[model samples]
Target: MKKVLMGMAIASSLATMMFVPNQAQAAVEANIGATSNYLWRGVSQSADSASVSGGIDYSDDSGFYAGTWVGSLGDGNGAETDFYLGFGGESGDFGYDVGYILYHYADLDDGDFGEVYFNGSYADFSFGVAYTVNSQVDDGSLFDTGDIYYSVGYGFEVAKEYSVGLTYGYYDFDAGSDSDYGHLQVDISKGDFTFSVSRADEDSGDDDTKFVVSWGTTF
Candidate 1:
């Protein structure tokens, strides 16, 4: 049932991106990267190990966009594939984004879900909210609809081609335990290549503080 809904959502987004005649000037982009650990929302997704990731995106001048991302998830977790569609535009000094994202775990049966999110940013500061709409895990025992996450972030340039960022997030679950976490990151870019170091603080369950390094490029 959940899988069916997931398929429908992806199909709908794809159709919209492909058939939307107004987006005739759409541009395509691709990115690839490697990370020492795959951390998602402050939780380790790659069992604290390294992973490879990549994605492709389509965007137009009208603020509509769609993309697909994939990452290797070490050991028994298999791979993670994400599909998202959104529209983002600037208003004065603020930018807003609204979108739906589906996370599909290949070879990890019952470990898939979807979320709808709204994000706003001004200058170097940002805030966002996400709500889980569906979960495929063990009949939604591990993750269920209505789970919400709130986040705030800030970033600043420290030097030429270097920057620092901070992020904090709180997860409120409808079925499971809740958690609060924070992340500090530093990034350096040279041409098309970027290097990053990120540290996360865990505030609940067995999640622990950890650090990760990564390198990536976009084309």
Candidate 2:
């Protein structure tokens, strides 16, 4: 499952750090959160239900970071677990990150997959892309790999401890899957709470506009 992989990834990150003693800054953190609706690329993963999640992350002064997250899906597939590791750093006003992430569904058949991603930001604008690579499913309809996701975002602080963010994303599915779609999301956050609204360009199939309320904290 994804949770299992995340645990493995965390352990691997720690092991790798052991060999680079001078570069290891050693910082571990944890996070917890709840969301009114769990949405992924404009689709509801929780069937429009609320879900809770928790995760731990390890980061060094250098740019290496690894983390895991597990959240209830509320659908028949049960919980979705994820693991990711990447390097990120800032240069003046620009920042960049490159990483690999794995998503696992413990109870769903052929639902485990992984992707390599790259993201960059300059000031308040950001762009990113992710490509699917390894997939556990072997069926003809693999439903994985060859899919790419592209996103552009802008964020700005409206006031102290308050911010607004807008993102537009497009998913390029593998050939023969006409399910490709694009979505735009707006989020307003203050402290630990956030309000988000999103709509997909496609009007057909579960593309209904969604409004979600969420809260999260890190320590």
Q: All candidates' lDDT scores?
A: 0.63, 0.69
Best by lDDT: 2
lDDT tens digits, residues 126-211, model 2?
A: 88888888877553333467878788888899999998888788877674456677887888888878888877765345577888
The TM-score of candidate 2 is 0.85
Each candidate structure's TM-score, on Cα atoms with residue i matched to residue i, is 0.79, 0.85
True lDDT of residue 50, candidate 1: 81
Pick the TM-score winner.
2
User: Tens digits of per-residue lDDT for model 1 on 1-219?
Assistant: 222111111111111222121245878888787767666655556766787888888889798888898877765667789899888877787877888989888786677888888888788887788888988766435356877777777767777876665666666766556333444444444444445444455443425556566666668
Please give the range of 10 consecutive residues that has the lowest summed lDDT in model 1.
6-15
Candidate 1 versus the native: TM-score? 0.79
Q: Where does candidate 2 clash, by residue pair?
A: none
